[model samples]
Target: MIIRPRPHWIHLLFVRRGSLLPRILSQQIFVLLLSCAVVVVHGQLFHWKVTLTSAPFSLMGVALAIFLGFRINASYDRYWEARRLWGTVLIEGRNLARHALTLTGGGVDARPFVLGLIAFAMAMRNQFRGRPRQEGLEGLLPAETVARVQAARCAPALILLWLGQWLQGVREAGHLSPMLAQHMERSVDELSAALGGCERIANTPLPFTYTVILHRSSYLYCMMLPFGLVDTIGWMTPLVVGFVSYTFFALEALSDEIEEPFGTMPNDLALDAIVAGIEASLRELLGETPAPAPQPDAAFILN
Candidate 1:
């Protein structure tokens, strides 16, 4: 997502990054052209007045806006929940690194466990965006371990399982106490919960039927809107309809993008940066320098 600070109030009028303008511009142009035609014809077909009243449209607009409001609310809930789950990942990752190293009393090399945490975050990020790249794992895991996970189903879960077994092995080797291992296991479980929560959001979406209904209704209302206004507004119908169409189209596009917060869109969550931050935190515990900072694209999006 775009990572820059909020623009100044005056500059906010001209904001582009994360703006809804790009997606809706074409549709708005079409609606505007349609409005112009409706104005030229004045809702008349073959000289028969296709009289349409603004009263019905005004009432319908209120109802449609309410439904759109509900959809936007639902989408924002998903977006916020995704953010919170990642926040959990960050906190739990840092905690795991500290607890694992300290409780092991330097008797065990913590690199493997630390790498497991990083791997889980990277794998989860890849799963969310459907961009599967394995280069990030080379620094964190051995070739053999990476090769084994590359073929596994739910690679993150599998890597976590290996970490659990590693902890068990350390316990057997007389490094970690059973209690410390159990505590570490709970952190892993919370990580699992966070992952499961994100998967739920990513895999599940707003119902298809609702989307269909909303889309058709929006188009119908916008197209028919000029008919309702052409008689009353006359030559100015295009300008007025264009402004109204912009609102409806922009809101709809915004809702669609934010509904799935894990995408590479400007408004979507910055999973790459979040994963990088997790890697940096874990690597620090391993006495490694921080990961290089993530830079935003020309649109100021950190995908």
Candidate 2:
């Protein structure tokens, strides 16, 4: 996610963004240097040669690769599920706003109110991620509702409360019939469900013990690898261990970074941009002017 122009020294920086390759390599280099220093000082390091066909390492390497692959795949599955839930939010959001406009039969001002409700969904999405956009949100809501919603810890819940109030008011004003009100309420319920699903995915992570096991095993394997190979490879053991460790650590770290897609990490699903897209769609459905454009930073990585 850190986009530095390709380093002039290397033709390709591996094209593997968001990986821990750099950090892993740096750590391995440090350890290798320390080991080299110790061996140089002892002068008895030549006796430590290891066999290339060591059964333990070969078997362990195969098992380790399989585990790392499984972990990465599972992490990606979680990330994608979060995205799919949000995608449902986007679709339902547009439908909700449309339902309000067509089903409510309120006047011109009411259409803006409906558009505002759509904006609230976007604001709530951002708020859940601990990123409330000050300008966009404040510009979208009634001052009193905004103040009250801001005061509350749960922004999405506040949005639902306000939405319920709006629907009730319209129903009372004779703009929305009982049947239409019921239909709109169903849309709100769907939105609420989407919110709950997102929260569940964000809150319930892969088990701590499982994550710890993989992480600990990865480092332990890398550490022991050099020791086992020191007799045969000498100083070259470090280079080999460094490369192998970099691959393992890079995959694990990348998976961890993206596991919680609601987070602010670069690889996290772009909830803000996605919400903005939903807002734009809703506004277009309502035929409103002054609709905000989709995010300019959509080019940034979100996968």
Write model 2 residue lDDT over 95-202, tens digit each, in one string: 777677666664724664565666566665666577754336666777887787667777777877778888888888888889988887887888788888878887
Q: What's the C-alpha lDDT at position 221 in model 1?
A: 94
Worst 10 residues of 2 by lDDT: 294-303
Candidate 1 C-alpha RMSD relative to the actual structure? 2.3
Worst 10 residues of 1 by lDDT: 294-303
Best by lDDT: 1
Tens-place lDDT per residue, model 1, 1-303, is 877765567767777667888788889889988898888877987888888899999999999999899989999999999999999999998898898888896657888888889988998887778765454777676777788777766777877787788889999998988998899999999999998999999989999888788888888999999989988889989988888888888888888999999998978998988999999888888898996877644454221
lDDT against true structure, model 1: 0.85
The local distance difference test score of each candidate is: 0.85, 0.70
Candidate 1 residues lying further than 4 Å off, grouped into runs, are 295-303
- Which portions of model 2 miss their true places by more than 4 Å? 1-17, 22-25, 31-53, 106-108, 132-135, 230-236, 289-303
After TM-score superposition, what is the CA distance of residue 141 in candidate 1 from its true location, in Å? Answer: 1.4
Cα lDDT of model 2 overall?
0.70
